[model samples]
Target: MLTRLTPTPPARAPVLPTMGLMLVLPITASGGSLGELKGMSLEELADLQVSIVSKRPERLADSAAAVYVLTEEDIRRSGYTSIPALLRLVPGFSVARMDSAEWAITARGFNGRFANKLLVMIDGRSVYTPLFSGVFWESFDTLLEDIERIEVIRGPGASSWGANAVNGVVNVITKHAGRTEGTLVSGYAGDRERGLAGRQGGAIGETGYLRLYAKHEDRLPQKGLADGSDKDDLSGDRVGFRGDWDLTPADNLSLWGDLFSVDSHDPWIDGSDLMLQWEHARDSGAGDTLRISHDRFEMETATSTDDASIREDLDTFEVEYRHRFAPVRRHDLNLGLGYRWYRSLIEGSEVRAADPAERSFELFSAFVQDEIALVPDRWYLTLGTKLEHNDFTGFEIQPSLRARWNPRPDSTLWAAISRAARTPSRGEYDLVGVSTVVAASPDTQWMPLIARFTGEDRMNSERLIAYELGYRWRPAPVLGIDLALFHNDYDQLRTLEYSDLRLELDPSPRWILSVTPDNLLKGRTYGLDLVVDWRPGASWRLQAWYSLMGMDLNPVSGSTDPEGVALAGRYPRQQAGLRVGVDPRHDLELDLYLRFVDQLPDFDVDAYGELDARLAWRLDPRLTLALVGRNLLSPSHLEYGVETLGSTPHEIAREILLRVEFTY
Candidate 1:
């Protein structure tokens, strides 16, 4: 299962000769068709509201952050069955597939399977693992049709979300039980994926509603380097229930839970979670909320040769309370308190091992934020801070300041400065052993060389200071634009160093190289993101975005590592996407998307372009059928590699899927 980890030279970039013309033609063709289509107006889309910025609902155009919202209509039209694939529409996010079930997703930069800088949550429950500070996307099997929207914030969110929210935050919100009041049956089959789902919902009482759903999916393996070989396949099942009750005129109660199991070629995973929440509101823009949740996840993985196997089990419990009110004539305030407990166990026969097989930790946090209006309706400022205490990092403080100005009725300008941190994980503090083994010389008689990685107890948290500026402009009822720029400075980054080398002959003659982690790296990054949305006529909508990024890294005065410098350029420098939505008739809809990703020189990944299309026909108000084609421009291509897990990266091939939906 292991493969050599080495830096390869960059290959020639892929060519798409007509890509530029293809993008331009859509905008030009829409100029004369604006009044002919019957669809949502641009003004309605511009007024979409999001809640991730300050934990309070606000218009997306007025937020003081780089934010994007994927609405329910956008999700249905795009025909994406997974969250990771849906995120590709965001302007600054980096989404890549590693295998049949695993994905690497991040915002801005620092993209990897174990990307520790991003925080993800479903509703109010955190999904990031405490073991590695990353998410296992395969375990998130919620029904896509039940999702209401996804909010993406591409900047430091620690001031509100606490630690490990350095680069970004993603919040996936689902619809209320009351919104779905009937029976729904959905199924889809394709060259690569097949799944079936059913849901039943009804009124529980005069003021209560409940819904229950179950789903199962089987995914075919990915294409390998050689012909006819396939990577690991995946299958999984999930069941969930949700309930909502209006306890009184001003009080509400909500309960939800999910249970799931996944079986794959190399791993088996199972998990369950439950959540309860209550809220009380007053007419004067004041409210109090309480939430409590628990989650448990277990995984078992082994190699094909059966020489090594690993098992992991994790459980987490969390409680939170918050209140919001207007404290003064022109000022609003919000405060919250949270507590979490985590327990984990690991057992395995592998190259790396943890010293303490079972361990537990606790986290306590509190935060406060205030928004003040400088002018009646034109200018505003917000300030917030969070204090947290945890086992890995004793105590840490995060703060942010933001300002927004509305010079015109349809435009907004905003800026922000923030501080965030990435706390140490179990693997960074307790792991030790031979990470890899390789031949020391061409001759087999020579002793094999081993790279031994050892953890350090004195590790410090990685920190970042970020500055951001953004603007949103709506020139007419048919078009809108958004722009964002950011600069980040990093400190106390992690790097590996060789401490010792020796020959061991007790078991067998071999060379052991001792490697240790240190806080000896410093770096800076800057990037820009731009998005445009236009509706030429009532029948067509066009959306496009472009992003640019650059990074610089160096070792401290007393440290030196050439490899660390090369790793800094592991992300793409440029990326762009174009999407067109059209309705030729009242019952027919079509969507086309094109994307281009720049080369990753350090990872030996070449630049490439992708095309996806979808068409749907509404036979009646209660039934619909759709067809989707992905990666239509090429037969196969590679998106990423997983060197740390010693797994070979596979190729993504063209695929087609047909779906049928019925509701009553």
Candidate 2:
């Protein structure tokens, strides 16, 4: 298991002798700060906010993509204690807990241990691994409070983000140092879980600010076999710091870094990983910005049945520059260039029966986007492309075009077409020797395939062509709706093929082996997204969304895996969720949320629904109390499916968590 925690010297209380200066802090200005922000009308919010994921400054409601903005208020009101649970609210996204800490999250289809479609980032650092082409959700943990907002784009973003942005993009942004300028301490111990966190932030000078935080938690036990058997336990810790300086009124610089390590055991396996990252941003002349970052991640795992283990390490560096050009009235122009390099190494022990291997690669790209106003305030068109090159694949180009029509102040319609790609992971292009078997002759020995670089060098990138259409409307002060439709065509999918294996005897017999990464399957995916928000009154708020998806592969073709079998993508046809919040009085708040997911194929988990609710009372400005309930429909329900070779289908463990949160 892997966890996030902070490891630093004990926190010391801040000494503030200026009693009259307390009111000068922006943080102490009011109690309804976030609530007041959320109460703003759709039009008000639209004009006050800008999103970066769009590559151009656009109002949340005016953007052409199907996007969702999860604010800090949403996190505070959600009864769920974990980050994964928070993700369930996003339409088209499927999030399930595999164990105490592991999670499986994807968009559209083919979600698994190696979900190769989605792209995730924190600030601007990509979290996808080169070893498996997927993210280890468990290893990505942070102090939820530090998050400013999460921007989720539900369709292809390859034109701007490059390969692996085929399905969706999730960007998590953190608050600036100026927003956190006080001492905060929190500690909690609940049924099966215990944790403590501390933060200290203040101004270093008139123009400089810094914040540091550390946290640790213990995992609880889960029932296995549906018989209350304690089969698994999880735990972890994390620590990090962020700082920023104002070099001038128009120029600013920022630096952020963190270190995390996790270790645990009990379920079917145990594992540990260490992650570190550093990022810098600088503003130059005339609306120009530059960013550079570096990251290192390492993880290892051991199974209960064997002493063998698998180890993986990855290192990556990226640099980006953005220039914004000013022009007459409605004209906006932007240009950007980025470079990324990745290296990975994996080792497997004898018990794992897998191969050991090492691989490294680099990807480079430059992009440009320009926004033109057709009718000052009524129409706009945005166009962009990414010209990229990689070691495994030669030069590649991805382009996108979008047009937005805003006939009225509160309504918009948009359409776009884009291209995206997915490069092969180390597992797809490499192999390793697993075991040794004795026979009558040395030539007759048998060995398992481990992860190793094979000399064949035969692999191609998977590509996608996407089309999207969308509409947004705000007919009244309290009602808003957004809808989007998309279609995708996939090609050059990488599939493994069966090859002959040859063995030889010292005196007479001999055998040969064969393998190939051939083009096997073509896939198509189409879907619809609908989001509705209604604020019936100042005290009551409601939000709901529904997603319908359909995916298919040309299975009539031949086999692609070593078993010579065709595999179909697995995902539910429909997923829906609803959330309601009510402030009965100024001091009392209540929230209810419900999520429904259609059963996913390839796994036996049947369709299920989860209901969660929370009640809170503001005892005073400094203290609050909350009672939370999760999985209220069932004490425990099957949330995920797991399968092993030659074994029966089983469900992941599920239980209830009683959590209490306090802030001062």
For TM-score, the strongest prediction is: 1
lDDT minimum window of 10 residues, candidate 1: 25-34
Give per-residue lDDT, candidate 2, residue 539. Answer: 81
Clashing pairs for predicted structure model 1, backbone only = 33-537, 34-536, 34-537, 37-538, 37-539
Off by over 4 Å in 1: 1-40, 226-228, 305-307, 440-445, 558-562
lDDT of each: 0.81, 0.67
lDDT of 1: 0.81
State the lDDT of candidate 2 residue by residue for 1-664, as single tens digits: 0111222322333343432433232111112233443455566656645454455556787777777777767776775545666788787797876656666788866665567888888776787877667877766767776777778888888777888888888888777766666665544444545666677777777766788888776766555545555534566677787777766655667777777776645212222222222222323323666777777787776454445556777778888876666654676777778888877777665444223366678888888877789887888888888789988777788888988999998898999898888887666666433222233354444433222223235677888998999999988978988899999888877665545555545444434344455557677889898988898776888989999988877632665354212224246788999999889888778888888988765666778888888887665444345666666787566665663211122244333343333333
Best-fitting candidate, scored by lDDT? 1
lDDT of 1 by residue, 414-470 (tens): 999999998988878877667446785766358888777777878889999999999
lDDT of 2 at 270: 21
